[model samples]
Target: MYVLIFSDAGGAAALLVVRGCHTALTAVVSNRSNGAGGNFFCEYDATHQMSNSKGELVSIRALVEFCSTTNCNSRQSTSANVFNDCNDQTTDYLLGNEVLNCYECTAQQGKNCNEKDRKCSSKKYCTKQIVHLDGGFQLSKSCSNINVLGIDNACANYDVVTNPGGVAVHNKYSQCYCRNKQLCNSGSSLGVVFTVSMLLLVHVMSTVVA
Candidate 1:
């Protein structure tokens, strides 16, 4: 697997692990002008950037990217050598293969954002992320195509927004869903969360009383 983990000063970094699949490494690009676009770099095609219909250059505020393998993001796998095995190339989109259509969103300050389609590559998984913060939360869901080598549900404290000009707020991604089927991450996992948290709270209270 080819892993690339880039950390931003604002704390918006991702661990991407690409294996034998042939798909471009694409990202949801947003600039300071509040413009949104897509950028991808692939082996067969030259690196390309997408802009709004007006074709203006905008400053990048945040970028969220991913890959299929979970090993790339593992806690113990923190090494720069993760990208040692990757070049550039994409396998042709196969027919009848499970091309996932996932719900995609990026939000800050607990405000909701527009949801769109995220057509995933073959053998990829759908992932959902819910970030919990002080008295509020943010939500995002997308496709992940990566090999699984270890546990997927791990958490770390990371910042999401660098600027706090009432535009974006930083939050920690607290929940993740990595599933193989299409649209598996479309539904919210709130019920499970409430139950688990309640149980933990009860246990803690009991321990305190004891």
Candidate 2:
């Protein structure tokens, strides 16, 4: 149990008389505080942190230094040659692999973070990109056309925030999901704005029939 409390004592009045038998275990209910009790202070290990399945943000799960980007944040795979499935351990705990992809990214489309580029090691397939949900970003280059590419043109005038009837692509090269702004029909650049609003509504109905 922490090797019988760091080998059974050495001041804090002999660890407050061995495991605080007289009460005083003062902070090691850990989230990171190795600073006041000299020599690897430790406690509170709920296996660190790993929350998912609908809380949204998927990566930061821990282990090692109680990992949230520590105990050596294992930085190697941007798509390190697409093999799949990997688990690690040094101090051992670096958590979060209950599954949803990125064991080196074959992609369930979450955190594939560019998969070591160079077109993902020449087509082992990650084609090096994973950004999704309409800034649209992920491309390994296979599908040349079938539509579904929106979110460019600077957010297409920034109106909808969440699901305002599905269809958007405001123009970063913008090309699909055109359901509004009159179906984004600028193909003829909106036919000169509908022929100058139909010639200014036929000259305001010929000046109200003269």
Candidate 3:
């Protein structure tokens, strides 16, 4: 099992747990943005931790990219290689096949983003992320083996608007995961397809606790 923890300067936190991946590979990446900054850290159980200073989004994107590029099943016997062998391997071993095709794109392509699809293994989900930053929002789609730490088939949204040191700063990040169909991440509002009730429940629980 792999455990990832993300926390920002504003006291917001999120946890992601990835299971059935290779046993040896482990990594922890963290970043501090210009204003109010954020930190992302993840660790795999059975090996040493690798750390990076890049942003949270970049860290996750790197993991997804790594999964897409490498075949973990072929490297299981080798020693842990930080970010290289972290892709989930158990599903492919058990199912013996790929299951879904997800729409793939990067935020950098801007308006000229191309239509590309990636095959996802079983237990993996098609993922879409929308990030609202200073000027506007950015979108990216890919396949991910990581799920929200506790909730199943859920979407996560974080909206933080803070005036730190009297400077206005706003950051909004949202991600959705779905495994029901192929190319499920093609819509603008893909997050709505996954249940947001978990978020609502968390809000209610926090309110009651306070």
Highest lDDT, which number? 3
Clashing pairs in 3: none
Residue 105's lDDT within candidate 3 is 66
lDDT of 1 by residue, 1-210 (tens): 222332222223543233322121111111111111112221211111112222222222211222344443232224554333322222322224545455555555646656643443332334555555455755665544321211232222233332334444344434443444445565553222211221222211111110
TM-score of each: 0.37, 0.14, 0.45
lDDT of each: 0.33, 0.20, 0.40
Off by over 4 Å in 1: 1-82, 86-96, 116-123, 146-173, 189-210
Query: Distance from true position, residue 126, model 3, in Å?
Result: 1.4
**Ten residues in a row with the worst lDDT in model 1?**
201-210
Summed backbone clashes in each candidate are 8, 14, 0
lDDT of 2 by residue, 144-194 (tens): 101111111111111112222453322111122221222132232221110
Q: Write down the lDDT that model 1 would get.
A: 0.33
- Give each prediction's root-mean-square deviation over alpha carbons: 15.0, 26.2, 14.0
Clashing pairs in 1: 22-90, 22-91, 23-90, 43-88, 68-145, 68-146, 69-146, 69-147
